[model samples]
Target chain A: MKKSSLILASAGALLLMAGVYLAFFVAPDAVVRIDDRELVRYSQKIFYFHVPVAETSFVFLLLGGLFGAMYLGTRKRSYEQMSYAAVEVGFIFVLLVMITGVLWTRADWGVWWEWEPRLTTFLVLTLMYSGYFVLRSSVQEESAKARFGAIFSIIAAVNVPLTFVAGRLDSLKPVHPTVFTLQGASMEGPMLAAFLVSMFGMLLFATSLYIMRLDLLRAREDIEYLKEELEVG
Target chain B: MAAGKQVFAIVKKDVLAELRTKEMVIAMLLFVILAMVVFSQAFGVILNDLDRVGGGLLWVAFLFMSMLGLNRSFVHEKDEGCLEGLLMSPIDRPLIFFGKMLGNLLFLSIVELFAVPIFFVLFRLELGASMAGIFLATIFLSNVGIASVGTLLSTISINTKTRDLMLPILFLPVIIPLLIAAVSATGGIMSGEELTEVYRSMRFIAVYDIIFLLVAYALYDYVISE
Candidate 1:
């Protein structure tokens, strides 16, 4: 486990460095025309990292849900730990997505924020899961905390797909340009390599964070258990 | 021994308790009325065109009012150790969810009964002749959606220190689809549009109600067991 974690950590660092170099230097600037105004933009470079992070966060969220269902079925403490870890990692990645999104919006949309569907839905998901942490902390009893947190996590997880569907199908909803089809030069060799590296790096970073947090939580629990044993002795 | 009898007993206990105290119902109704008055005063200039904004105001009032009722209902159970007793009973956990949801729906509907008229009076808008029944259906279904999910979340939140504040924070995001559906349906009805136009939103709310209720019902056991 230690060796694998160390490998992931090194790979993540290497990928992040590659991503920064490629994003700033290798990727060409994108030109967009809005309201007949041709805007030559460089900040479109954020897309390489932004899109992959956002995609990864959703994957993490879905994994969290899957772990939540497992916890409910097996009633095992490990599944709950994994689920909590996934959500914590998901939160960090989602926050990074939001920050990059804001930067992109300010450059492209002439505003720091807009209520576009993707942005709005992601905002809602961020709040909903953050509330999950608050829910966990509010309960003092370990058993009750685990039970309620698991249940809430599962419920909130089900809402994610529904939210995505609702955002897509609502007729009154505003349109966001589909990233894949948008006008941009297709990824060249170096840029593609850099993007993949960064993506792998983010996954490693997320895994490391999850493992660290879980270890800390388990250690805390161990301390509490030993204290109780000492008191009884 | 009978399932029906157990369900009846649970419902009766909740109803009788609320009847004697009138705390949850009265507080919810008063809060809705006061909120409406405050809204009206705040938007006094827009009163002349109240119909334009009435649908939004009605939903805002309902959302906050439901929050008030949900928090109070669970707090009452927690206050007297009644929820612990309920958990200790041999009855199915889902039944408790149903009983509590029914009680909340009943109280919310009664509050709406008063709120609708007060809203019409203050806002000077009348439901169109053709849309009255659809409006009622929207209200009924919206309340069911709110009560079903609200009951389960309130149970979870009641254990937290920030019980009152926590309910809305935890609830509003989960129920955003319901809010959007209710507001759109109400808007459609107010504007004398065809029910078919609002069918999508109604179906959305119905689907949400079923999915969430079933999820909440299945999970209630774990929540109360701990």
Candidate 2:
């Protein structure tokens, strides 16, 4: 497990660095028409990383919920640990999405925040997952904590799509950048390549982090077990 | 038949218990009405116009008040060893969830039945009879979402160390989607928005309610089991 994570980490880092280079050099700058004048958006480059990170965050959150439901059914300790770890990793990417999203919005929209649909939904997503950790810590009994965490994760996951759709209400409006329409990828060739590379890189990197966190959690439990044995002996 | 009977028995027990104390219902009523008072005073300048944002105010008050009632619903069971008695009974675990959730729903509805009129009267917001019916229906739909999710979460929260404090943290986030839909539905009505828009929001609320109800039904067994 350790060796694989190290390998995955290096491969992911390499791909991510390549992705950055391609994004900066290969991808054309996005041009927006304001009053019929086309102005190149230098900040549009953040879209590559921002979008990949955002989508990756959704995948991790879905995995967290999947593992959570699995744990409930099987009553397995490892599945619960994976669920917890996935949520933790997913949360970090969500924060990154928010940061990059904010910077991009500031540059493009000229506002620090707008109650746009995707933005509002992501905000709700962040708050919902944050509650998962708080719920975990507040439970004293270990098994009960796992049980409750799993339950909340399942529900929170189910909410992701609902919040997203509700976010598109007429009042919230549709201000988020649209790239992948039903017509398909709205990007040129090199740009799509950069996006795909960054996306796979981000997924691999996140997977490694999840494995490392799971290993650490298991180690902590082992240490606890040893300490109890030592005290008894 | 047996499951229905068992669920009814649990609901009856909670209703009987509440009747004896009349504590939660009265407090919930007072809390909601007082919340409107606070909103009236705090948003004094804006109090004159409750058209655009009145739905949001009603929900803010209702959400907190619902949390208060939800927290209390489970505290007594855990404190008085009633939970053990229920567990010891031959009823299935999911039936217990339905029972407790229905009781919570009943109380929440009763509170809103009174609070909604007081909200309208106090705020002096007027709506036609037909509009009022839709408004009440929207609130009822949202109440189902709240009571179901609340019952499931309150059970989890009450078992934690910081039981009361834990609920809003857990409950509020999960309830945000419902809040959005409910507020939009009610706000649409208050602001004279299109009926189609209000119905769309109501439909989403119903969807949210049904999904959570299914999730709770599937998960409640693990939640209550020792």
Estimate TM-scores for all models: 0.90, 0.97
- DockQ score for candidate 1: 0.57
RMSD of each: 3.0, 1.4
Expressed as tens digits, the lDDT of each residue in B1-226 for candidate 1 is 6777777778788889889998888888888889888987898888667655677888998999998988888888899999889988887776888878888888899889887887777666787665777888889998988998898899899888887878987998888777777877788778766668688778888888889889987887777775
C-alpha lDDT score of every prediction, in listed order: 0.81, 0.92
Local error of candidate 2 at residue B65 (angstroms): 0.7
Q: Model 1: per-residue lDDT, tens digit, A71-163?
A: 988989988888888888888888988898888889777899887768878888889988999999998887788788788888888888777
In Å, residue A40's CA in model 1 sits off its true spot by 2.9
Give the runs in model 1 whose Cα sits over 4 Å from its true position: A33-39, A168-172, A180-196, A229-233, B1-5, B193-196
Candidate 2 scores an iRMS of 1.1
Residue-wise lDDT of candidate 2 within A1-233, one digit each (tens)?
69989988888989999999999998888788999999998988999899999998999999999999999999999999999999999999999999999999998889989988898888888898998988898888899989999999999999899888888764877978799999999887999999999999999999899889999999999999999999999
What lDDT is reached at residue A106 by model 2?
97
Badly placed stretches (over 4 Å) of model 2 are: A231-233
Scanning candidate 1 chain B in windows of ten residues, the lowest lDDT window is B47-56
Judged by DockQ, which candidate is best? 2
